[model samples]
Target: MRQYWINFKGNQEGPMSLEQLAQKGLDETAYVWHSGLADWVKITTVPELNDMLNNSAKAAQESPAELPEQEPEAVTEEVPELETEEVPELPQEEAIADEVPSLDNVIESPAPNYGGQQQYAMPVAPQQGPAPQEAPKCPPTNLVWSIIATVLCCSIPGIVGIVFAFLTKKYYREGNLEKAQRMSDYGAWSVIISIMLGIISMPLSCAMNIFKVAM
Candidate 1:
């Protein structure tokens, strides 16, 4: 009977007999055959066996020494060179050093205007502006709606809405318009749901009220 070393779900569990391994969902393809260890070695999940085989095959193909034969080296004979003519030399001038031009003497030409209009010299912009920046606009407050929602949220659903509304208010005060809007939406939806549930329960509550009235 064949022996196998099973590696399953990141755990190295067994060196069980092949029959035992098979009972645990092990198969010939699931594990690699290792002649040196005289056992089948499992690497990954059973379904990944084909991928492992392809990877192994690719690794074997990429190995260097398995390449084909080279062509024979060619022999070449050296040829002799012919003699060339000599060239004549020209005379060089002696250096006369003159005083360098002063910064004031150095003239700069005005930049040519590519456009038809005469180009006005551009003034450097100030690094800091004196203008006072306008403060960011505050989000619109729905105080009445907020109070109504908060009162309705006395129950579980209403409480959730009130929590969201509080969060929205806090974010709005902090100048986080986006987060405030999101929280407000949550509060609004929760308030609507809670109101709907309360309205639905009113009929049953009214029946109980009628029974008490009759008694």
Candidate 2:
């Protein structure tokens, strides 16, 4: 007969007989005998011993002496700053003058008549006294002129040509060849004027460049 301390339920109450120990949840498979220790060791047959060991370990971990609170370290970072640039302003008079060339130089041209001699030409009938004139049958020529004018009117000239082209196209489509021709002519003139203005501005631009260098 041998005696050993064993825990059961929630209390330690073991001084029981070996047979009683066996009846109280102790089994031969639950314990290993250490003959060198000279004692009959109580064995545990409970399947939850691993869980109990884990819980004991967790309790040991949670003990204040086992784990101390650590102070968090502060982190710092370097940031880059963006550089801003200032924009230069242009003279108001120069801006206004740049727009004036396109507006002021519109010139109208006369319409030509082939007198029914050309291919795809419309025949012109002689008018009797106060005869009503028939509408012209050609596609609107103002579209072509408008396109040309728009190209030439770049900067300021383009604005004037576009306006003239629109107005002239209306009259031209209504069988007014004179008005259409006038619009087309004005668009051509605007192109020429714009080119001349651009040429004249080149010298001023060159002078400004030289002045800038000298300054």
Candidate 3:
């Protein structure tokens, strides 16, 4: 019923109802004039125009805007199934029962008689473990001679002779025949050396005793 005039694009558009002005997309900043207005004024200053603009803004906010439609997604391709393989069956075996012999099939051997003594097959003397390693055929340690030398001659070479004699016995026991023989020779030599030293020192010792007696 009430008519309003709008300054549309710096030109007087005019004489339209509030619905026409709202449809025209005018805002509060738009200049408008009407019969009761003194000169051109903003739409925000007029109660009727301002109220219409607010109501229109509220209605626009309440409604949703339309969106552009999207294209449908591409159809997926199906995968082909693989071929199945056939397995060969195994052959079955027939079960066999154990065969036992009767007493008629068995042959008995006659036992040997030894003057009625029930001889148990003398347990084959546990194969005598390689004949006890036959004590290595080595030379005798000259221990007695070494001891004799130690007691009757110079102590130094005599003691060495005794040591060699013991080493000969030790090497012989350890299965070292060559070392045992060598130590035996060493013992003999040491004994000989001791006897020779004792012989050489005897006259000197006697002469010294004689000299002391004379002095």
Candidate 4:
């Protein structure tokens, strides 16, 4: 006799014979396994279980009908009664009136004088600072002389004088009074140098011309 195993309700049920398996009233689709089989198969596919399955079906059909279902007994539950309670009544109170204070009940007193005892603070004038010193005036820039020298005398020194003259005016406008004064002196010197060169060059040029005519 060959024993079989089946998975029933998530558990490996048994190494039971086909006769015992048929007694379990298993469905045709139930999975069964034995050592002879490579994998679990449905009972309906097994030739050995065919006769047992047919017998089980015939026996289920010929079985006597189940007794008519008995009607469930009607349940009767008893509920307990609740007791009632009585509350006592309280006495009523009388209303009270508001009271006002009389002047005769209060004592009178006089306010003290503060006439000469308090000293008044006098307002003090803010101290004035010495008047701001006036800014010194800009020295002569000699711009007119520098321009005249640049036009009529030596160009190099005359152009230098004109540049210094412009610098003097620019520095004075920019609030640099000391630098402006120095630039003014420089412009004056350049103008004087140009005038001196013009004077000396004129005499030398006249002497050369006289010599050339004599030769």
Q: How high is the CA lDDT of each candidate model?
A: 0.39, 0.37, 0.53, 0.52
Off by over 4 Å in 1: 1-143, 149-154, 211-215
Of 1 and 3, which scores higher on lDDT? 3
- Mind giving the per-residue lDDT tens digits that candidate 2 earns over 29-87? 23212111111122321212222333334545686554332101100100110111111
TM-score of 1: 0.30
lDDT per residue (tens digit) for residues 99-202 in model 3 = 11111111122212222121122112111111111223557677787788889987888889889988887776554557889999998899889999999999
* Candidate 4 residue-wise lDDT at 77: 9
Which sequence of candidate numbers ranks them by TM-score, best first? 4, 3, 2, 1
Q: How much is 85 displaced in model 3, in angstroms?
A: 56
- Give each model a TM-score: 0.30, 0.31, 0.37, 0.38
lDDT of 4 by residue, 1-215 (tens): 34566643223466686657867877653555544232334455454454456555665666444212111110110011011111000000000011112111111211122222121210010011110111246768898898899899988998999899889878765545678899999999999999999999999999999999999
Position 195, candidate 2: lDDT: 64
Report the C-alpha lDDT of model 1 over 71-94, residue by residue, as the tens digit. Answer: 011001001101110100000000
In model 2, how large is the Cα lDDT of residue 169? 64
Error of 4 at 158 (Å): 1.0
**Model 3 misplaced regions, further than 4 Å:** 1-136
